[model samples]
Target: AIDTVKSSAATWTEPAQSTTAAATASVDAAASSATDFMENANAAETAAASEAEASALSIGDYITAGKTRSQIQGYGGYTDIGGTILTIESITDQTITFSIVQYSDSGYAADTVSAKQITAQWVKNTAAFEFCDDTLDGKGYGTLSYENGTIHIETRSNTNHPTKLVLNEDLVGT
Candidate 1:
């Protein structure tokens, strides 16, 4: 009778031990899977953060004040009017404000003088081009041209003129 009782106990204990071992393995597997998922999520977040920083604009990217006429022409425009960047104020993620002067020759064949307040906005499809929809005198819009290192700001025409203001990075602060 004693031997039979001992044998019964041994059988019961062995099954319980096997069940405990299986449960432990299952728990370990679940924990490892959860850890892997967390690691992957962290990696994705880090990559996204890096991409945003890369897209941020810098001050130098907007405009360089006081560029000479010859230097401006190198970027592909005629320096018919000599101008220097007077000031750069209020820079944002999408806009910048600056001042420029040009020697105009429309009045007397000699270079006439003019100053313009330039507001530039970031355009998505066009990089480095900011459309100036306003003028120094609070005009709603103006004819802005950037060609041959010269930027021309003229009165905004209402005659459905195709002379839209196109901004180029090369024309900024020149």
Candidate 2:
């Protein structure tokens, strides 16, 4: 019994492994992956920006401004957006050239800015193309939706008139 209980208690030292290098490597890899994630996100942002094309205002279509005031007056108040309707003279993949026609100036100093081209960018949404106001200098004037060869204009107005204008048919209904 004495021998079984040995004079000196059996001492055991647990084996251990150094994890410093492994841990450091794992942290470094994670940091690298984070950088890659940021780069990918930036690339996706760029792609989305470049994805905008022109809208569906054909040459000769008429577009009556929702309300000719602030934004519709053109950059630097140079254009009064004169009178009532705008006659689209030409349309490209990125711009709409139009001329104000039909009536006299409403209030602002009369200025019939002819051949005025405005940025008309849009992104395809399934079967419709929605107006891309990303170039509005952080201001959203309204929304334009084009589908089935017709233009649907809706101002983000919370008062008076809402959800207005339909190009082809149902012009009176909207």
Candidate 3:
């Protein structure tokens, strides 16, 4: 009886250790998966923040704002430099009916978007909303300025494809 008991004890201890190790491994894997999911969720939201901005803005209120380099994945990033908001007429889902304000540079009262130098609206597009142009990621859309909360997009490259608008960062949906 003693011999049988000793043998059983040794065998049981090995399986118990194995079981514990397996459980530990499973728990670790689950934790890793959960962490990955949370990271991906946050990344997805940041990437799609621009879309959310487009849907929730008023005319005159800037759809695009701030200075950030345009990524080259889409159409072809607009070589933005940076500018201030001037005036805005409208920024609807179908049309960004801006009230085109005059972006001041030195003594230039003339309007039209500057080259990729006037940094504004890092993410603006027409394909998702207008169904016309791709991303229009060519040159600087223009220099935008602000006048009493109204916005203006002044650039020489205003084409038929209505530029899609991106909302300011503070307004992105959480």
Candidate 4:
């Protein structure tokens, strides 16, 4: 009778040991999976920050401003009516105003035309607006003014020669 009792107790102990081993293995696998997920998330955040910094431009990017005709004469001489140089004085989100100086034989001349004599046109990304001269023989110069989200052009002919256009914005148009 004592031997039968001892055999039954041994059978119960074996089953309990097997169950405990399985539970411990399951816990270890769950911890490993959580660690891998955290590493992948950190890598993605770093890449996004780098891309945003590269896309923006500063005021110094306006280096194209104030280039003289003598400097650019190698590329193309400023002989015709379209040889005007643009100098970006100030720029903002809504407006950009610059000084327009034409390469004259005498030097740089003021573009003075009545507001009514100038015609305004709008283009895409290259130039926001263009001011053209309104005349029969096309012998007037125009000045461009960007203010309050609108462009104003003043066109006038040289007092000495009407045939010679002074500040021709058509030369600068792309």
Candidate 5:
């Protein structure tokens, strides 16, 4: 009877040890999975923030109160250098309108020059805007970049002439 009891007890102890080891393995696997999920989620969030920072300017942001208008002088081109004013008229969700106010820099009140309205739309995949109006006369497009309320704009002609404009934080009336 004693021999039979000892054998039965040994059999039970072996199965019990195996069960404990299996439970430990399951717990380790679950912990590893949780850590992987957390790491993946964090990486995804960081990527989203980076994309947002690189996003193009929104027209609505330029049309808000106390941020309505900006005036920039042109540079880098013989026709536009020191003789032009790029006046920001208004910005819509799909379009931006501005006027190229020209002046005769020859120190004479000679002739009357009209302001030309140039309208443009945002270009796909380039993060820039393209002028489709008659005012450009086959010149190229414009691109805008903003940071901390300061805006930088560049208009490039087809001949590779680039006119740069910088807008500071002071608000101007339309």
Candidate 6:
């Protein structure tokens, strides 16, 4: 009778040991899958934050005060000039006040010009270009887009002609 009892106990314990090992393996696999999911989620979050930062703009990105120079050329009957000095006098929540200094040439003194104000929406960047459609004094209101080292300005308030202007970054500060 004692021998029979010992054999029975051994058979029962063998299956129990196998069941415990299978359960442990299943738990380990679940833990690994969960870790992988968490890692992927973290990577996605980081990419979104980076994209937002890239699209955001600051005041300095538009133009520096007393530090940017714009070469003005007119087309389609608009008044033409050699160059103009650009300075941001004040930037408000909805508008930007500009102090323009016009110059005929290097041999001439800067012309006394009136300050210009334009809506802030015109200076903000959209996609690959920075553009605006706000009024800019006697020159008439138009939509202008700036990209690379060039500006494409179309005067709507004028004769609705497009003008192309090249930016001279070298003369920005001078």
Report lDDT (CA) for all predictions.
0.45, 0.40, 0.40, 0.42, 0.48, 0.43
Alpha-carbon deviation at 150 in model 1, angstroms: 22
Residue lDDT tens for model 4, 1-174: 898888988898888888777777777777777777777777777766665444322222121123444533223454432234444544455555454434344333343221122222323322333333333233444445433222334456645446343433332221
User: Which 10 consecutive positions of candidate 2 have the poorest summed lDDT?
Assistant: 165-174
User: lDDT by residue for model 1 over 34-106, one digit each (tens)?
Assistant: 9999999999999998876555432332222355544332333644433333344545656655443332323
Candidate 1, residue 157: how far the Cα is off, in Å: 19
When 2 and 6 are scored with lDDT, the better candidate is: 6
- Of candidate 4, the 10-residue stretch with the lowest lDDT total is 56-65
Per lDDT, the best of the predicted structures is: 5
TM-score of each: 0.41, 0.26, 0.34, 0.29, 0.34, 0.41
Candidate 1 segments whose C-alpha is farther than 4 A from its true place: 60-90, 97-119, 123-174
Q: In model 2, which regions exceed 4 Å deviation?
A: 1-18, 53-95, 98-174
- Cα deviation at 46, candidate 4, in Å, is 2.7
Model 3 global lDDT (CA atoms, 0 to 1)? 0.40
lDDT of 5 by residue, 1-174 (tens): 999999999999999999999999899989999999999999999998877755534333232123212212222333422233345666666666665433343323332132345666734322365543232334456665455443445555555532322222222222
- Candidate 5 runs further than 4 Å off: 56-174
lDDT tens per residue, model 3, 85-164: 32334444444443322232222223223222121232343211112113343322444333333333334333554443
In the range 39-152, model 6's lDDT, one tens digit per residue, is 999989989877665543323323322322342422233343345444544554445544333344332333223224444443453212122322233333444343443333
In model 1, which residue pairs have backbone atoms overlapping below 3 Å? 77-148, 77-149, 78-148, 78-149, 104-112
Q: Report the error of model 3 at residue 85, Å.
A: 6.8
Query: Cα deviation of 126 in candidate 4 (Å)?
Result: 14
